[model samples]
Target chain A: MNLIIGNDITIGYEGEPVVSHLTFSVESGDYICIVGENGSGKSTFVKSVLGLIPPLSGKIVFSGGLRQDSIGYLPQRSAIQQDFPSSVTEIVLSGCLNRHHRLFGYSREEKARCRTMLERLGIAGLSSLSFQELSGGQQQRVLLARAMMATERLLLLDEPATGLDPQATAELYSMIDSLNGSGITVMMVTHDIHPALNAAGKILHFSHDGYFFGPKDEYFKSEKGMTFMKEAGHDHH
Target chain B: MIITEILSYPFLSRALFVGFLISISSSLLGVSLVLRRYSMIGDGLSHVGFGALGIASLLSLSPLYVTLPVVVVSAFLLLRLSQRKGGGDSAIALLSSSALAIGVAAVSIGGVNTDLNAFLFGSILSVSRSDALISLAVSLVTLSAYLVFYHQIYATTFDPAFAKATGLRCERYNNLLALLTALVIVVGMRMLGSMLISSLLIFPSLSAMKVARTYFRVSVIAAAESVAAFLAGFIASYALSLPTGASIVIAHMLIFIILSASGLIIRRIHSVIS
Candidate 1:
């Protein structure tokens, strides 16, 4: 079943299209990797899907029990987060800020769920620690746990491995792969041509010249995908 | 000793009460403001307050009547500007410096020099009964507003983009925060005065952050620190015949130094033990 459909979308700011003539759909349990250079509108497309910015033209519909805000999103690391003083548990609990409950306090069940998410992410022991004190991989996992508290169906990650070491990057990708195996749809924007090009069942490649979106096998054969793979320093036959 | 000395003089009592309230409100708002790196907004808005008061005095109208709307609007404008990337600090500096210039012009033209010292540095004896009442009301409102919106404020400060993606009206909560900060600054101007008021917002939060690892604890400690500083400073002002705002700011500075020293000691001990 299709969870999201982008119908002939043209996205950018101030009515100037950055990457236009785009159309895509995300089906349930499918992993879609968005690959492109910087300024390729990949981030812009993520914002549009997250409803941070409206598309210049065309409709992107969220269906199949998905609201626009219900998707779990792990945003890129920000400078403000580097030294921010917050406990891990509170960060996870913020994921449920929009949940239907009392305005002031989280319900016991919600608290329990957050605890479980932390445990599942293997960071329950670190829940009491301040966020900025954690290592890069640990922080990313904590954020993933927070995003997990938000939704169980879809996850959107933007360059989740930007600043990680090789081992940590492998760990994060494997964690994401396991999540996809458990029936959650993932749409990740990444510069990781290898994992992104291999693990993702579909590819949505944005470019300054144009864009491409299709199944991975077809993308392996397409002209734009071939050029992208070549330019990204990887050749797949 | 402090309580006895303060209540002996009604004006001192009034100054302490109002100063205490302003301290609490400013510190409470200071947590999110500091976390978001919007601490300078308080400084900026207070400058706007001075400019607006200048206008009010120039036209011989009530200062509160003019300062409230003008500062609040300026608060919203700064919030809007800060949302955009690049030059946010420069923009704030530009606006605030311009407001200060206008304030100087207006004050000079209006010839309110007789009241200038009280307006700039704050005077315990100059706070009227009406000003005390306004401070009380604004303080209560600011306190309750922070309480009610605490969760939203937390999420927004931590990450507004993520908060927005989760269906929060980030702009609305941000506006609410800005409005409260503006209200606090305008009322705090009565006691801390515009020149010293932003210190109330900065010192307490930074000091609390030195010792606390969590947002809730940081804000709570900030409020306690602010009130304690104001209490001690107010009493000291009466005892030593010092400037109220200067004394209170000194108190904050001293506490911040003590906390920083303690925080450093605790960290060193923890590392040694580990």
Candidate 2:
């Protein structure tokens, strides 16, 4: 099931183009990691896919016939304020803000779904805790839980393990692997390649100059991939 | 006591009602401003309102008519300039400083026989029926706008990129929030005086955030706190024959300190228990 297709996509800010002539198709249940340098348009590509930035020129087709509500997005946790004074439950409940509900408030079923998603993510105990008080790893889990409350088909994560410790990173990736195994498509943008590259089936290498779309095995086999990794001082496993 | 005399007067009742209405609008708008990190913009816009008031008094026009449009237009310009990629904070600071300077100049230069004390410290006794009606109308409009666009505001405030990706028009709503903030400042100036209005905008909301876990609860508590502060300040001012605006601001600060201390204590206890 093809969930997203971008043909000849070009994205950038008002004056300059960041990434151009990019083409890719993501299927349901496919776990893809995008790797690039700091200014390499990885986040831009993700944002473009999510319709945050209008492509300079291209067509993005959502072939699975999924509505906007079916898309779950976990943005960079650092981008949000930790001391925002919202409970884990309240933050998670915001994922359902777009859903149809009664005139009064969220239905009991919605509340149950929120609780279930938190429990499924193994953070049910943090439900009543202030979101700001959670550890970085715990905060990411709560955000993931919130995203799950919105959709089960596709999860878009922007650097889910950027600030986590080694142990936490391993745990987070394992969780992601399990989620992918359960048939949820995951697209993540990250600057660090080792962890995500090992976990992702497909690696999308991006740069301000261009991008390469291929499987992980083929990526390491290419000359450009070797040169790119060598220049960044990262050895391939 | 002076408090007993003020409490027994219908004029004092009217003043308290006006204060309450302005506080509600300020607290609600304050949440959006704080989240956007434009908390200082409240102070800036209030200063602009002061200039508008001076202009209005000089021209013998109703201060509300002159100040409302001036402050709203200033807010619009502020939003417009801030939307440019790297211009947000600088633009707000520039506008605020210029507005304050111009306001001070206008008040001094106009040499209008208007009572400067009433303009600076607030003269609740001078709050006419028409001013009350205007305050009520502004409150209704601001509240209705908030209720209607609550989801959009929440989305944009939490994650602008996500909100944009999800097909929500963030710029429009962001500007609308700014416009509402301007309206609240203009309306609140009559109660708190332009110099002190921004305190009413920020203090209660900050205090509420110290304790409330959800945005909804924070807003509710903020509104309640603002009303309480207004009542206490009004009574204190009457009792001590102090300046009403200063008294109200002091009351709000006192509440914020008390609430913040209690919140700290509760958090320590929770950590220990957990």
RMSD of 2: 2.8
Q: Which sections of candidate 1 miss by over 4 Å?
A: A231-237, B109-112
Question: Candidate 2: which docking quality band?
Answer: acceptable
**What would the per-residue lDDT of candidate 1 be over residues B99-132, giving only the tens digit for each residue?**
9889878889988696677677766776778888
TM-score of chain A of 2: 0.93
DockQ of candidate 2 (2 decimals): 0.45
Q: Which residue pairs collide, candidate 2?
A: none
lDDT of 2 by residue, A1-237 (tens): 888988887788774789888889898888888887888898777777777667888877887875653578888887897668677887787676656344545679989999998888889999888877788888999888877777788998899998999888878888888888888899888766665457788888886667888887888787657867787688867
lDDT minimum window of 10 residues, candidate 2 chain A: A96-105
For B1-274, candidate 2 gives per-residue lDDT tens digits of 7656776787787777778788887888888778777776787788788778777776778889899999999887777776678757776777767766666676777785455666766777667888888888888899888877776677678767656655567888888988999988887787678889889889988999988877788888999999899888988888888888899999999999999999999989988999
Clashes of 1: 0
Please give the range of 10 consecutive residues that has the lowest summed lDDT in model 2 chain B. Answer: B112-121
